[model samples]
Target: MDLTYSAQDDAFRGEVRDWLEDSLSGDFAGLRGRGGPGREHEAYEERLAWDRHLAASGWTCLGWPPEHGGRGLGLLQQVIFHEEYAKADAPARVNHLGEELLGPTLIAFGTQEQRDRFLPRIVAVEELWCQGYSEPGAGSDLASVSTRARLEDDTWVIDGQKVWTSLAHLSDWCFVLARTEPGSTRHAGLSYLLVPMDQDGVEVRPIEQLTGTSEFNEVFFDGARTEASLVVGEPGDGWKVAMATLGFERGVSTIGQQIGFARELDAVVELARRNGAIEDPAIQDRVTRAHMGLEVMRLNALRTLAGSGTGSQGPEASIAKLLWGSWHRGLGELAMEVAGGPSLTAQGPPYDLDPFQRLFLFSRADTLYGGSNEIQRTIISERVLGLPREQKA
Candidate 1:
């Protein structure tokens, strides 16, 4: 991967930086550094407005094709935009589920009508979306999903439950995977359906987390209905389309996530110094290792991006997931350790968790969610390394 930027890329970076500084100053100033992981409950309405503001300025979907209402920027320019946005500590994007995951899926797999109907709304920040792949039984084993959907006269009827759905309560739609063929097992006979969330057949209940937040939720679809044409790919081809979405999930946005991770590590280091934990050899060694790991992680991500196509990522994306999931979880542990005894206690009566405390608690799930560490390793071994597949009893 080229480490040097051309003059045009540098100019583009300046444009992004200037826009962020100018726009985030007055009315949106309070949104800076708000509504991230563990803090998703903060500034709900305000952040949604900030998202719309981003859309209006044409900064929302920088990488999408111009035909789809995006700027259609090159890969390096998109990278610069994400880095500059994170550097400004701008409000966490509220529409990432739509922009990053579902938008690309539609462009790559959706029919022309699907793209015409969904892409513009996604770019405009008018319709937010959530993923409905995980269930109580199929958290990491997506092929084991039990959600079933069948086509009636004009609509597809859905019935199943999805857990760990982030921002379901605020979303306007859900892209779901369901069994459309009876007696089909594993990944076969599945269809990817885009179901609306406001109908009477759908119910959403928040799941409180260790951080005392309910950003994640449980969605039950009794007889939820969507247009039969809402399916992304042909019936029984959901596995291919869903896997492509997963590839997009781990795409260029991760570079921005690593930038955020670096900021978190910087905070941890500052805490260690203030508490004199930096003087301890053990603490110092761990901090050095964390810093080095961040560098390695960034390099690997860039390399992966270089090899990946514009719309889909390769199996090497699993390596990125494994790296960051483990690194962020370790950073959380380091934060608590540097804080020492004070980290053990809540500062207030309501059991409030400070930023570091929340980091420690929320990062515990990093290696578990998205795809578990075991699942990532399996993908790396079987798909990337061409190892023999694990024997299924």
Candidate 2:
């Protein structure tokens, strides 16, 4: 596949770079410090402002259809925009679930009314969203979710708990998966719904981590209610609709993240150089491995995008996710090693800050979230290698 950028793509990249350099100003380095844990309030506000700026310029939803609030750019332009945004070290808008997963799913499956109501809000950064999928008992085994949604008079009453919900405390709404039917098979009884977060009967409690911050939440829904019109697709068809959301999550969203990770890898190499670790053969080897991993991921993203039009589900997407997570964790670990003692502490002078330390702490969740590496391996084996499915009792 031709991964080369055309003249127009190059021009778009340059424009995005210039705009970000001019518009995105706040202590991004400080925001980077606030990256790990609970309620980086200032960081969140800055990111929201940035999102609004991009939305006003029609840059926030670059990949969306023009009939929606986007510029309707192609995949190449989207890639270029992300690359430039990473280079600028801009704080990414905190509405990834809305922009990446829910918006796309709505475009593909929602009624025109749903699209008109939700898509514009997402583009304008007026409504923040979180994915309400994982539960205490169900994460990688997503189809095993037990959150129940019962049809009432003109509404669906939802009751269950969703754990590991990122940014749920700050989200305005959630796109959730709930069991609409009991006793059905794991995948068949599920349904997807859009529920407002601030309503009564919904409680969000933060889960503090080892990093001494809480970026995720335990969202408890006790008789949460939404109109029947809020149901995405048909009831009992949520398994299929959920796949569309997860496919975008695992495919396109991962590509955007890999771009950011590549930049962080570069920062690691520079850190090694500054710390006088570049001369060590071992350090050099680690850096080389990180570079190779980034290249593989980039190529895989390109291949996936190229074959996207043909409706092909290649193994490269899983490979990309697996490799990116592992490589990022490695880079984070290596950064700490190169930084030596100072990296152990989370606080220090600006230039003396240990990026690796923070990254290492955060990277621990990479393999666990968004379908673990083990799960991806299973997908590759069954779907790509033509292996027999493991029989269940």
Which candidate leads in TM-score? 1
TM-score, one value per model? 0.99, 0.92
What residue pairs are clashing in model 2? 38-214
For model 1 the TM-score comes to: 0.99
Runs off by more than 4 Å, candidate 2: 25-42, 251-255, 310-316, 346-353
On residues 34-77, what C-alpha lDDT tens digit does candidate 1 reach at each position? 99999999998999999999999999889999999999887778
Give each model's clash number: 0, 1
Q: Report RMSD for candidate 2.
A: 2.9
Q: Which window of 10 residues has the lowest lDDT sum in candidate 1?
A: 306-315
Tens-place lDDT digits, model 2, residues 310-350: 22234546766787777777877888888878876657454
What C-alpha lDDT, on a 0 to 100 scale, does residue 181 get in candidate 2?
87
Candidate 2 overall Cα lDDT vs. reference? 0.79
Please give the TM-score that candidate 2 achieves against the real structure. 0.92
